[model samples]
Target: MNLSEQHRDRTDIPNADWESHMRRLRPILDLLKEKDRTLGEWYLKGETAQEALQHRAYDGKAPAKTAIEALSKEYGRKNKDDPKTVGIWNGIRSDQIGASLSLEIDGGEIFPKSLEISLNEKNERRGSRLGDYRSVAEVLSEVVRTYDSFYVTYGPFFYYTNKVFDDRPGVSWMLYLPHVLTSSEVPEARALIPVTRDGKQQGTIIVSVTDEVFDVNNRTHVKAANDIEIRLADQDLLPRYIDL
Candidate 1:
């Protein structure tokens, strides 16, 4: 899972800095390794341990287009774009943005090896894309189910209320990747940096870590849980993710 191209920034993150950053992050990583004990909101089990929390989108009725749009926008709003935005339950959601993202894990798996997200022909707005994708988006949806794994990043939203920072239409830290990134493609980049998410989206990385990714203040925040001021593309390391 090479996530290099998922970032919008393209600056060179110094090796020395990365090493030092990891040293500071290692302890947290150790804490994260014990993922089972950590509880999500309401003492609900975390991603590794769940109590039958399934994300039933559209009730198999609404078109994927209407479904995903409603899901992203309203969810983005309710939490003020806080990356840890997710609510768990069954039945249907009533929020204008959409259903609450109920992130759950089967056994110890949170991230899917292969993803099957897509927009329908009737969907007026475009969803995620893979420009280099030889097949159409519609076809990819079917193929993804058979894939072993997929490279990906999060979408855009304001961090910390009013002051919104978006990285759409460009490969920001949270680029929408459809292919597996490789060390050969970006030799300088590291793989699986493991960013953390708060609340339900915890233990996840939202952006691509590159030399150029930075915040509005032009500095790097090694601690992901609190780096709300930083957005990956600020430093100039935009990505052009590819699919094989």
Candidate 2:
């Protein structure tokens, strides 16, 4: 096997398919690591990343508070010691869905917040608050957590069955980090890059294109939304999934 084609030992998917995926995905990975500057994976900031949609409320002339938000608030007050729940999302970068919709990302897997502590924070001790870092940092953290929990048990990908909108199952790939910058326009996927640990590569970085890249001028609004997205790791990736 070549360098890019070395990590396909999964029994879940065919080795040939993994090889093909790696071959096509290598350049994208390099660009992500070099130019794109991605933090792989993201956790869901939704009110209930682990649970389904519950109660929801609205603010006047605007989208009201959601059940997840309410629950999060309670957790902040009473459950301070309890690590907040979070999850990662994967969505198709399509214009069909308006930016206002919360259900944009078609698929995701919810996990506990404690995993973040075990993977990296304990090892490197990147003393940064979730609010302070850019979008990529949180996304990268999620990628590692996902790999540790799901990939170790299953493989690089899994069969994601959407609970609500689309009941049909889709093959979901893990370790793909999206290179995202904040913006007002909806985000779109540009490519997927490989994720590495130590000297070897592990996951894929997702390169996303937003209507506008976050900069000083555009960041206020973008960052606010990112603050929310950071709380609820729900961001979109490329529109590709196997109809398994």
Candidate 3:
């Protein structure tokens, strides 16, 4: 039987559009599965399916807020007298900062060791001056170099799952890190650019390190270092495999 006829006679099926939907959804699902595989190895390190989902949800929201807060404090004016500062602060307070980031790896195991930053929010300007480093001493040094006028911090690391469903839409997830750090010893730095997947730029993940946490709608408190999981977002970006 042809595709439409086969689906039509399958009374057990839940919907009439089942076959058509599956045809379109199959590729997306396969892509999601591949993403999950790559991200799972990097971040989950053998967590259960449910555990992975929980981790991604938490990671996505927390770091976005922390990044927003860190940026606000740095650019916002301290005195009540500066109208520009006050205006900027008020604008930020009223806006919502969304999260959209991922990582790009060269092979299956190696992290690219570079990041790219994309700012889509209004009145939001990201700088490299915050205390952002792998160590505390480096953060302190950046502070001295900037003459105590500037600072930088690292945002949270995000993680996600790599599972895909055959009949369901392809699913991807993300988690944001818990702590924020500033650049005290070294100067602010830029993230490395990512290449396109399948001749498209949508799948590339961008990342950067910063020095401080600015103010946002929600404030993020730091969690222990061991508690953070480092992973990138997982989503559908390629075609699926099907047995005819």
User: After superposition, which runs of candidate 2 have C-alpha atoms over 4 Å from their true positions?
Assistant: 1-138, 141-189, 210-244
Model 1, span 1-244: residue lDDT tens: 0121111211232211212222222332232223212211111112432432333232222223333343455444444222321232222222221111232111112222222121111211232222212212212222222221233432222222222233322322333333333444333332322322232211222333433332323223223412322333343233222322
Cα lDDT tens digits, model 2, 1-244, are 0000101122343322312322332332332234222222222334453432233222222222453355455455533333233322212122221011111110122321112211111211222212222334334434353332222100111112211123211111112323333323233323334445675655444322223222222334234333332322444322222311
Model 2 deviation from native, Cα RMSD in Å: 19.3
Which of the predicted structures, 1 or 2, would earn the higher TM-score when compared with the native? 1
lDDT of 3 by residue, 10-30 (tens): 223232221232233233223
TM-score of 2: 0.22
Clashes of 1: 21
| Candidate 1: residue 153 Cα off by (Å) | 2.2
**TM-score for all models, in order of appearance:** 0.23, 0.22, 0.17
Tell me the TM-score of model 1. Answer: 0.23
Q: After superposition, which runs of candidate 3 have C-alpha atoms over 4 Å from their true positions?
A: 1-17, 34-204, 208-244
Better of 2 and 3 by lDDT: 2
Q: TM-score ranking from best to worst?
A: 1, 2, 3
Q: Please list the residue runs of candidate 1 whose C-alpha ends up more than 4 Å from where it truly belongs after superposition.
A: 1-38, 41-151, 154-176, 192-207, 210-244
Judged by whole-model lDDT over C-alpha atoms, candidate 3 comes out at: 0.22
